[model samples]
Target: MRTLKAGALYFVLVFGAGFVLGSIRVPFLVPRLGARFAELLEMPVMLAVVFMAARYVIRRYALADRRTRLLMGTIALVLLASAELLLAFLMTGASPSAYVASRDPVSGSAFLAMLVLFAVLPALLPSGAVSDNPFKPKSVGGSDSFKR
Candidate 1:
């Protein structure tokens, strides 16, 4: 249940951010930078959002372990990807293969790297580094609330 809740939050935040970036990318950036470059430009912004979202989820949930946090983030990314694909089909009526083939190799590879980073960011930091649990105060002995 905790994982589900955290994953949902991550998914919502990331997807919302993506929608805003996509809006800009499609019209403003794409025309000037072309589809691939526009996507690459959006990558850094989305990656920033992913880090913020991951931290938010970790702090909000007081996630205990790197494993659980990683799992939650991965689940969120999977859901976000699924949602994006669905939206693409609905908006453009493109089949999956066509959609995949439409991607510029460079931008697509960068996007995939970002997705992997999204899943791993939560675990990259030690557990207590991102959490503030009022109920589970840190001990002076250097024991972390997440150690359990």
Candidate 2:
């Protein structure tokens, strides 16, 4: 289903981006970057998930109402955030893991930020926007492609 594929794409976007960023040493600001980059590392994942979810709604589902686009973004963010947190657990004991939850800061910060970001994303998606938008009408002749 389109939704499932979208979700998978979101996961890949988040996981892949995080992994890649995590592996690279910042060219200009290595130490300082390491201290602040976790959230930045998450930006692409968040944007990709939201954009895709919005596209999914517009194309396959009904994004006619603003509520729908927001819903899609919310769902995408939640799924991505869940995947991130799970990764955090898997990473807790690694070498630089102390940099993560050191004295519980990462835990507390991640929890708050993830929830706020995911919860607000949908509501913030721009309305009446399109760019070769996939959310356009799926059927040209007033027909549902999947129905017989």
Candidate 3:
């Protein structure tokens, strides 16, 4: 349930952001910078949103473990990627391979790197400094409830 909640929240944040960013990119950036650079520009925005949203979910839901955070983040990424590809196909009527091949080399590589970082960040960023259990009161020793 917690994973689902976090995943849903992540999806909402990323997808909502993509919608807004896409509006800007398609009209303004794409023409000037081309499709690749426009997408590269959007990468940072998406990463920032993902970082903030994941942290918010972690703190708000008290998701302490790396596993849970990773799971939620992965689920979010899969959904985001799927939606993005689907949108590309529908909007341009381009086959997946054709679309991939069309990406500018530099920007395409950068985007791939960003995707890797997105998968790794959630697990790496969150520290297990807090406990998820509500009944166990936090002690001076921190996450180790028995230490006190």
Model 1 stretches with alpha carbons more than 4 Å out:
133-148
TM-score of each: 0.85, 0.48, 0.78
Clashes of each: 0, 2, 0
For candidate 1, the C-alpha RMSD (Å) to the true structure equals 4.9
Candidate 3 lDDT over residue span 1-148, tens digit each? 9887887787778688879998989999999988877888789888898777666677667877889888887887787778878888999988888888887898889877876676667688738533465346556656576655
By TM-score, highest first, what's the ranking? 1, 3, 2
lDDT of 3 at 41: 79
Which pairs of residues have clashing backbones in candidate 2? 58-135, 59-135
Backbone-clash count (model 2): 2
Model 1, span 13-112: residue lDDT tens: 9999999889878989898979988898788889889888887788888887989988898889889889878998999998878888888899988988
Order of candidate numbers by lDDT, starting with the best: 1, 3, 2
Worst 10 residues of 1 by lDDT: 129-138
Q: Candidate 2 on 91-121: residue-level lDDT in tens?
A: 6643334534452456347545755655455
Q: Output the lDDT of residue 112, model 2.
A: 55
Which candidate number maximizes lDDT? 1
- The lDDT of model 3 is 0.78
Clashing pairs in 1: none
